[model samples]
Target: MITEDNDPRKGKRPDPRLGSGEAPDLGGFTMEDGTVTFDWTQTRVRLARLADAGPVELGRRRRFFVARDDLAGVKLEFVPPLVQAIPSTCQSLDEYLNWLPEGLGRHLIVLIQAGASALGLWEEDRLVAHKAIKKYVVRGHGKAQPTYLRSKGKSRYGSRLRLRNARSLLVETSEKIHEWRNESGPFSRVFYSCPVRIWSGFLDGKPAPPLSKEDLVKIPLDVARPCFDELLRVRRRSLVGRVRTLGDEER
Candidate 1:
């Protein structure tokens, strides 16, 4: 009958076995009656702060949480380089989905940019498929845009060029998504992290494809590097079936 509080060992180190896959600790949850719930409130706050911190600060915070008494038995589960929450406005995405009736969706993690996109087909927290868009232009740089402005159709012509680029980018992205579905998709929803302005352009611009209910999560474009690193980490860790597993736009 070990309770959450009152332990004299308030900052003991976690068990090394907790993350070795030999009886790994997957954190903990509370169950009352037949319902199970995880207290993500504090975890979400911690994650938000971590998302804004630098490498040195991140390490400091990680070490702090790793010694909490409440997390003593499961500290390793939430630590960085494992599976971090990576703060999002959609922090409650998974929780909201859990409230649905049933069979409504699957987990999908996407990292998007104006120039590229990465899609991950996740089964729960495990990534089952990976897809990417190399270099698609919504709008080009320098001479990529026409230098000459015709007197007759200058504005209209420029609009058409932009639209053309947008459509091309959209078509390529949709094709990849469609291929994923055809191969093994029909995903329930997408937890996407992309620049806010770029995403808005994609959605608001004409000839855009439709998205499902509450799918996109607008994260700053600066987070792309760290996000990609996190994805690679997950992929490498998943190789063993056991192992373990943002920034910039605010200026």
Candidate 2:
């Protein structure tokens, strides 16, 4: 009959600061329901100071989060004004901060699945250009289904056609992306959600988009079927910052 507090399996909470050593004196912040959020304009200065101080731990290279040792139970997370690559953990706080844009800039968003994709370029918060591409890449009746490469029945011919179209879709997607960048100028960042299976084909296009791996930030949220409206929803959500506090088990 071990009580909840007496459970031996539960260890003491680890410092939320991610063990950067000594804790700083962050006394005024509060976490409601283990989380909080801050607006970019209001908190940028305060965030800069926290990053400059010592004994901080970074959570992830993408969708960056930082916690100072002094703030033992709370973590400060950053959401890019739009989707963008974040500096790696190896980089210094100054370098990380420098990577963040002072204000929103033009960015590209690409949502891709087996048979469909949506691409859009945005300036500030306004969508400037967008395109949606779809193809018959799926076999049978299901939506966005992949072709069965080894089918032995009459579906085999259809499967092969689907596979070929899938490849073509990737090439078309890449070409369109390239065209947009050429007409609109370089994008500050590229946010994409391309599946691993098609990633090589996506990049192998003869005139692929001028995207560098370092500048690509994978979309972190689940997206429904690729469409222009879905792109707008994702863009809006990416700009909001979220803060989370560690629970006993999490710490």
Candidate 3:
């Protein structure tokens, strides 16, 4: 069902906060129309005592187990709102829309993986950085080739896009459609990467980091098929501290 032609971003669109701090220079990116803008505030939700500003739900939501069998959790829920998230070193594009929230100045065209939350960022008075998004891997790539049109004509270089379903019109395929006509790969996406950090403490605040089938043996795990482990029955907390930045320059 892949259809979004020309897609040089089809007409383009991005940047959203929804208030007044500024948001318009878009073909360059600097958005922050403001509705809840503190520019995604950044990690604070630990209040079981820090005087408690909110978000300390942590235990007692019950009925979720594994070695005992109860299961059933991920239908979606958890939409408190506020987001504008891009962070993998941010090479440029105007220092990543001046760090977004208004600077999404390139006419705001997100989805090279959240280009760091521009769509008005979750209006309600921004400052979102409540934290807990760990291990993000946004990723991006779209050089066509996954086609399905086969035919369409109009002329004058406008409408005539064909490539529809070629499962056997020949033979050899699927190296991601031979790297989408391989000029050396990635014909459209250009390039992208993600880290998106902000995680401070999880498994309790419930921001979705619970997987454990033994945490799938440390990392590269991808065997989905109803393997919904639910972090092996939830109870594993103890992060609360970690900063790392200097390019994650650890030792």
lDDT of each: 0.40, 0.62, 0.20
Error of 2 at 129 (Å): 0.2
Best by lDDT: 2
> For model 3, how does the per-residue alpha-carbon lDDT over 181-250 read when each residue is reduced to its tens digit?
3323222111111112211111222223222222111111121211112111110010011121112221
**Any runs in candidate 3 off by more than 4 Å, and if so which?**
1-19, 22-160, 164-251
The sequence of per-residue lDDT tens digits that candidate 1 reaches over residues 48-161 is 433334211222322212211232222211332212222323223244223322221344556655556666665543456676665423334432222222223445655566
Which pairs of residues have clashing backbones in candidate 1?
Answer: 81-245, 82-245
**By TM-score: ranked, best first:** 2, 1, 3
List the candidate numbers ranked by lDDT, top first.
2, 1, 3
Q: What would you estimate as the lDDT of candidate 2?
A: 0.62
Identify the superior model by lDDT, candidate 2 or candidate 3: 2
